[model samples]
Target: MSALAAARAARAAGRVALTVPQLLAARAAKQPEHVAVTQGSGTLDLAAWQRRTQAVAAGLRAAGIRPGDRVALVYGARDWIAYAAAYTGVLAAGAVAVPLSTRNAAAELDFMLRHSGAAAVLHGPDGVVPAVPIPLVWDPAVVAALPDAEPLPGPGPADPAQILYTSGTTGRPKGVTAVHANLTHGCRLDPPLRRLAHSRQFLHAFPIGTNAGQTMLLNALDAHAGMLATARFAAAHFARLIATHQVGSVFVVPAMAIELLHSGALAEHDTSCVRLFGSTAAALPPAIAAGLAAALPQATIVNYYTSTEAAPTQTSMVFHPDRPGALGKATGGGELRILAVDGTPCPPDTVGEVWLRAAGAARSYHDDPDATRQVFRDGWTRMGDVGRLDADGYLYLADRESDVIKSGADKVSTVAVEAALHEHPDIADAAVLGLPDPVLGSVPAAVLVAARPLTLAEMRAFLTSRLAAHEQPSRLAHVTALPRNAGGKVVKHQLRALFDRPDQEGTP
Candidate 1:
């Protein structure tokens, strides 16, 4: 059947008929020769990618994998095309794909394998598979040689498609179960190939298995652009790739953005081809945003706000000189609400819990009913962020509820303190956490990575004008780097350990 005919049939059958595998098939049918993915010196075309995935699906079926069975994918970003093919193949075989990070230690990997009850493990050449016994283990070469054929009884849109574990910054990571519909929510079947396309190449360095990485993978199939990714992110390497590929659109985290701004790599490359630059994972500080705008004058800098469990219903803001700190209003039929603790709607500029109800967001955690109920209620998901809406409905983030530091009679936002620190010329990166205080219960303390030697007195004087007395850091420590997770968020809990030692406290 033709791609258009299948799409029409699927629409008639309702939403359950459309899935990720079907989307890939549609794109491959329309643009068979288009470059689908580029990594370093390698490239994979659309038709060949589709064919390889089909072969992988056949191999999984021959290995006795069945619908709803979990298959863990272990690979790095450098082998992205092969990983994409494997991910698609798992869906095509009607099995759930669980993508594990290559950075995970043996214990972490073992826990995930046991937690998800994964039936088989598929990995790249260098991937580290856990020692836990599994029925099947297939390397890239093994699956690559399978005969090309579509597997029977593929997954429907309503079927559980993937299991993504959250970054366990606060506690043990929980698995987020996403249906095929959630995965393919915004996919475009007949995406424009000419003038309407955003760019010839979309560049990002998000590792495999992350929500951002998965979103980029879908864009590769549906956004009418080839994807360019790196195994690991280094500011200079990222800038060089953009110039080499003439990449038109790029996505990054705020940490990556800060690195690029300070590394002087932008001056070393011809980055004039970039037209769209986006930041996600966390709010981009206004200082970094302004620097990015100045460096890439032709690009539109966008800040996206969304959580792993509340994806597809995102809030985005295109940088405007007037609203430098706003995260913008909802776009593309998304919904947002700021509500008080009592569930009342907050008035304009009132800080409250941010709730979102995006179409096709994840329904629940994989097997944790208690965790699911805590965040998901009455069709709305609490974003775990404290924010306020402007009179015009633009959202301004204060901080994550878990990160707010209670200092004496006042509650201080770590984000606010960090923003103030970022404004200082010598400070490159900053993280604020609550340290135990005898008088104030918990006081706001800061750790900073500075370009030059900085003293606590200088920091206090610089922040005095910008922050209230209670909001200023009480204790300051100078460090070369701040501890960050795989997703680029500072691990505040890890920083707490620094204060536990008596010798590490106070100004350096």
Candidate 2:
């Protein structure tokens, strides 16, 4: 072959589409009639999905949405099929999608819409449209009825694709902008990799609009297996789906994982079909991982650690008996660093701020350059937590910078305390927080979900061998359950309210 011909072939290959919509189009072309996603009783096939998304795109285009326009998607977890079409349609229309969960309150929806300056909103049937000054479209059925037009040219790899709002545990949520390249990172078209090679269908209950849900959407587009999610997550029902469908792969956040183990949801069900039990949206405590492995002895229990800001760029750790609370090393152009206050790298075994960056386009806070400058520096994204790397490069997280307790002169890791607490058979679930103190500035307090009342003295005795003196909880609250966000992270900000009064457990 001539050099000119070879160069021309390379150029042609490079011009192939690289966006999410393009991935969907490829699937539609390759296996048009294959079922792609299922939510409750609804199922959408690749061919039908392509046609529906095209019609929706035409509707958005006719509604005056142009390239780079921010279109908010207010959808519920139950509307996965509709949301999938609308999301792809937004991309097909060359506009950026801003996914807002139906779980979000009126105030949250209003803030995100106004903040993104959304050109329009495509709301699901159950989704509430805040009274923002933007064009509001009806449910997915309305857009699906619109006549399909010739599909618009796919966006470039670097074109802005979506804005995901962060789960605001410490403060107000910020919109993190991800380009097409970033969204499609690790995805392929030529001989597309069959993720979860052992699974025919993968199950999850992640709420729409969360980073975890977005990854599920990507899975539906390119993964070999179809995706299934329930409208509302319940441990019994989640277990039932696995048993009934003989689901080979499953995923959940740590909160759901704990509920499954503690609630006895899997006791009556035959969950032996689960080949992959993946925990994400937060780190899985080693004890919880061990329990899950015992439940599904055949499955490979895996934990993935990632934040909304540092996604596609994450670390995964297969369940290991030796690595306690370790958030695996980076792979495939992913970078993980422990940086000191001055931004210099910390040596192995030294705790510092965790920073991570993926190979694709960097994500930034939408329309907030000042805030973006703080988190997205150079090409790395600060993880907002302090951790250390082992000589082998495994990351061991200590605590979030805000969650660390300063007991007199000692700095305490709530994660370490919580991990120790998890080992106690009496504690069903637990969270550690720093409560204000006149002398120490702040001290560690524990809120627990247990079968019966447990005293601080008992907890201290049990944890004496597991945690340091400064790390032991001085205050305790026995509650029914911990307050969690849609992403399954503990709402520590609200946990403080528990200590205000006493319950079955003695007063703090």
Candidate 3:
């Protein structure tokens, strides 16, 4: 069947029908003795995990959380187990689960809590109040007094279960509303037998509140597998945990791979058990992909191209070496298209924005219809990612549409510059951004990490040979490290701000 037809069938019959609670229950029943979660020192087997979540749900219900109420979860990687329990607990109690990263700025946090109108907040490590006060469940004494109760029953598929906050890469963050049916739609696209049959354990080290972490947790629950956790991703700790848990898989951002390669930590771990290594959130540059494949030769390196608006669109497995940079073809449940600026489909090899229509695609940004309308068209979501698909159907990402550098009259992709710089042996990592220039409108600037001291002359010479004159960096700043978020994507906006400041002017 064609991809479009497959999506239609999935939407009509609900072939991907499965709920958050149901998936967890299936895993708990099928493998009661299997380890379902692991923190630094704590381990919860399937039965225990199920029971904890139910008890947490009961606790939430007893605390007056009702169906449709939004509860905010602020957490990092190590706290995933408890918060994962809370996510299902919130849903099971008929309340909507709102997951937000603890790493977000206080202003962002305040905006999310106030905008989401979250009734309760689950604080992670630091219970300290925000710079600006907001009510939260940070008082251990009060929480300690509450009794463990049974899980509450919730509404059917139509009821809201999860709300993922946007990365706010462009503007203010908006919460993406996902009902039980949405999650069910996501689970159905890939089966446990296909994705998880050979892999019984995965190391989930991403921030707990992000969509990628939620996807991993839900999948683990569906497959009845082990999840080895870490406080955050410490290269040393990650290596040790992989060895200790005999972890079979992991989801990483491209930045993480850069760190792994720089630290030479991969050689420290007994990584033979890692059967699958998947990347998402940002483009996994060809240099990093090649390095990771060489490092983990036995592992299947898959890159899933998706966004908060569209759950899971396209995925490329590293085993398919034919299309090296392809993020993968359109999946069975979505229509993937590369559209020109005018919204017309671009021909093969012509770069354009990626648009996707999928079963589990987010309904809308919670309350902002204007922002929603910008990305959500008649049905499809304009993912704001620029890429091109080969005639054979392989998609190659160039950059986020917003990340495109408008240099004077031309639009240049920063990714092209980064990719060119990554070819430099002395370069450990590179992030390209456009700094405001009175003369050029926006001049390309580069922030890079080097194995040894690197000067602009060398970098310019290297990139000048590989990149077009317009695409070459107008300024190159050698930094101790690239400015990146925990997920491993370069914080281009932050980098732009860093160099644009008056005090740092003319340093490079």
Q: TM-scores across all candidates?
A: 0.96, 0.95, 0.89
Report the Cα lDDT for residue 425, model 1.
79
Q: Comparing 2 and 3 by TM-score, which wins?
A: 2
lDDT of 3 by residue, 170-247 (tens): 677778887787776655433546356546677767776677777777666665356666667777777777777777
Residue 145 lDDT, candidate 3, scale 0-100? 43
Query: Which regions in candidate 1 have their CA more than 4 angstroms from the true location?
Result: 1-6, 12-17, 192-196, 501-508
| lDDT (tens digit, per residue) of candidate 1 on 191-236 | 4543215678899999887889888888788776788888888999
TM-score of 2: 0.95
What global local distance difference test value does model 1 have? 0.84
Task: Tell me the deviation in Å of residue 21 in model 3.
Answer: 1.5
Candidate with the greatest lDDT versus the true structure: 2
In order, candidate lDDTs are 0.84, 0.85, 0.72
Q: lDDT, candidate 2, residue 77? A: 74
Best-first order by lDDT: 2, 1, 3
Quote model 1's TM-score. Answer: 0.96
List the lowest-lDDT window of 10 residues for candidate 3.
Answer: 1-10
